[model samples]
Target chain A: MPGVKKVGQRTIQFANPPVVMATASIVGPKEGEGPLADCFDKIVQDTYYGEKTWEKAETKMLAEAVEMVIKKAGLQTGDIDYLFAGDLLNQTISANYAARQLAIPFFGLYGACSTMYEGTILASILVDGGFAEKVVAATSSHHNTAERQYRYPTELGSQRPMTAQWTVTGAGAMLIAKEGSGPRITHATVGKVVDQGIKDPNDMGAAMAPAAADTIITHLQDTGRKPEDYDLIVTGDLATVGKALVEKLTQQQNIDLSKNYTDCGILIYDPSQDVHAGGSGCACSAVVTCSYLLEEMIAGKYKRILGVGTGALMSPCSCQQGDSIPGIGHAVVFEMS
Target chain B: MGANEGSLLDKQFQQVKKQAQQQQYQQMAQSVKPKQTWVKNAVAAFLVGGSITAFAQIIQNIFQSAGLAQKEAGTATLMIMVFLGAFFTGLGIYDNLGKFAGAGSIVPITGFANSIVSPALEFKREGFVYGVAAKMFTIAGPVLVYGFVTSVIIGLIAYFFQ
Candidate 1:
């Protein structure tokens, strides 16, 4: 905690807790269709980014999310002072497009799914330290959009395993303000990037679990709290497979979070919803955390919460070339006063 | 009165006879005749088909200049060329061209796009929901979903093993 500065420990109780003011999801109308269908149809519809680039879809979602947040906050575009965002796409098109439309001073960040936390942490810091009066944090993901741009075209037949998390096709945005009305982010424990360099990209959940557990355990240690201290500890986009793996591994580390720990990936997709095992994406964590969990928090359903965002640092090209995947996790704690 | 009735009947009979004569002449003119015009049709098809391929090459050049990777550019070139080829085919020009050019248009990305879209357009007449919707995704859905899932698994394995 030496590098961590305690800025404004008392003067700032977020008049509006960095609450998710609003959220939106822009899925291609062709649900259950292939990537080719979505891209082709989008091109026909004259969508600007429709040429088989996932960057386009991510950008669209980010733009939509920003629009919704601005409207929800009942504020004009000029009212916002800073925009912090990121995504998995190269160059971070989601943040870039959103920045272009919102036209505010921007900071582009990347931590994979942990991007949400990165945005949130930065916003909180800016607000608490009195650097900015109001800041908005947002992130997004798209299955076909990201896949075609990052990997291969949709027409190439490939095999998949059950252990994988479905890259979610959605986006989420949140507004953090210094003096509004919302739940304040009270405490946060930022984690170091941990990489085990696991070789398989398909089983990201398993690969990321150790880092997730490490961050969760470290956050608890630093905050001088136990697993029971927070009502719920949520990890971003660690599917059912990763969730189980994290649970088992944390127990080995003498940290048991079985009952309270859950994954955003598993929660977003109803297995009955036929989303194929669980959800995975930058938005997997962003949307679920902002929309569902924050809604519950606002309703006084959960008091103290620990939100951990996990990321797998493997590119499709590197994976296809047989390179090992490195995983990272970051944790941010939120409390309701 | 008798003279007038006879005259009117005679006029009506002449009119019927004239109509029958014209009908017979029109039938003869409308009859299908086997012409040895295959050579002409074939030549037309070839010229049109060649022009389509040339246009496709132009498009490919443009895309190449725009910084598309070779594979992507090739696919795009194929798509455009095939679509043009299909248009000429519909005009009865491509059939002749096919006989001469011999799969020149049929062998590239243009041909593949034509194959997919032509069937898709045909299916669209069946309705957007069942015909176009169901069949369109049939070819590409599994591939993308597979790529996505496999990548995730690959990412996981890489993380875990490390």
Candidate 2:
């Protein structure tokens, strides 16, 4: 049972680890102005992307990202056994519509901002379990669409508080296969929905920090690994506030995530951009991981990395009804093969 | 009373709530959740809001000096300010100003025009009926409803008192 697939309570160690064959990141104009502008596969000049609306643009981004990932792997669409995709829209219309166009076996997911790692975890499970040979995990989030759906109309002149994170307008896709020459997903940690009674929607980082800490703690305990074991550890969309909170929280658990830890939200945009706290959304992690992390891993900059996708599970109605924001964190360990 | 003074059930409830708060994480998050620049925002509001009002007054004075009646000048000033608000909103300038000016831009009549015009222009894509007409009042609707309600109630109270 030492090499057993089920490693611990919350983590699964793949006996046959799935390789990340390729990754593609497509970001909008605002994200293009960010520090990781050069890292993206394509920097779209228009939020509409020649589409009718921002939502449709998000759909196009996800579809193009999936197509681009498959192309980068030099594989046909028929080569991909299954496609896992999600977005922040209600009913995950972006994922569904994108899948509708892809014509592959699709799994529509909704984990808020954590959908990227959530899809990665699920895809890895399928590939590692000998279910499918090639599975592509893709997720997207548009700044305008997310803003209109969750907060306010895109053109609303209301000043967002400092804690409010700017939703990233981008899409990321990764082709995970049984055999590939790239980083392999070694261990996957499934996070539980952890709510800390944080009610402020603007303070998503605060809401998600505890959940990220919980998952990180669980992954560490289950794998018997320390913070120093990984070259880099990142939490998705936690931004500056959540990153700091995760550090202190993990320190309390004696995990000490300070030295090797960073956040996608903090990484995607520079402080000079005035993106309030930072970036948050499914694509915030998806884009950063698929682009910067993928490139760095391939360049041998990071040997092993832990990506924790953190999501605040709150709806506009729930927030309005005074329900606190519950959050989840899904972690995927990637090591250079 | 001792620091832990409470009923047994209260103590239990407090414990549960504390657990939900994820004590350390929540405290750390609260401590670092991005401090609001209250003073800076206030200063900006004062400067921008005052400037807008002064500009409106200058426009009114201009109208009056142009041989318009005092009441006509006041009415013209309101129209021009609202026109400017809507025009700038269409030009996509008011939103940017509103983002920076905060309450300064929002507390004025121009802000009210912006509140209405912004949604109308944004939702124009859904067509004039549902998109523009329906969503036009999204921001301004509440203000109109509450304003009218309060005014009617105040008028009734004043009439009864008199």
DockQ of each model vs. true complex: 0.01, 0.56
For every model in order, what is the iRMS? 29.2, 1.6
Segments in model 2 whose C-alpha atoms lie over 4 Å from true places: A1-3, B1-25
Candidate 2 structure quality by residue, lDDT tens digits, A183-277? 99999999999887788899999899889999999998899998899999999999888888888888788787768899999999989988999
- lDDT string for model 1 (A1-337, tens) is 3333532221123333454444433434322232222211111223234533446556876877777787778987788889899988877877887788779889998887778877888888788777887788888777765655454333332224455557877677888877766666876656565554455565677667767887777776665678998889999988877787677667866888887989888876656644444778887788777766776777898888888888887787788798766677777766666
**Poorest stretch of ten by lDDT in candidate 1 chain A:** A35-44
Candidate 2, residues B47-75, lDDT tens digits: the string is 99999999999999999999999999999
RMSD, every candidate, angstroms: 30.5, 3.5
lDDT of 2 at A76: 98
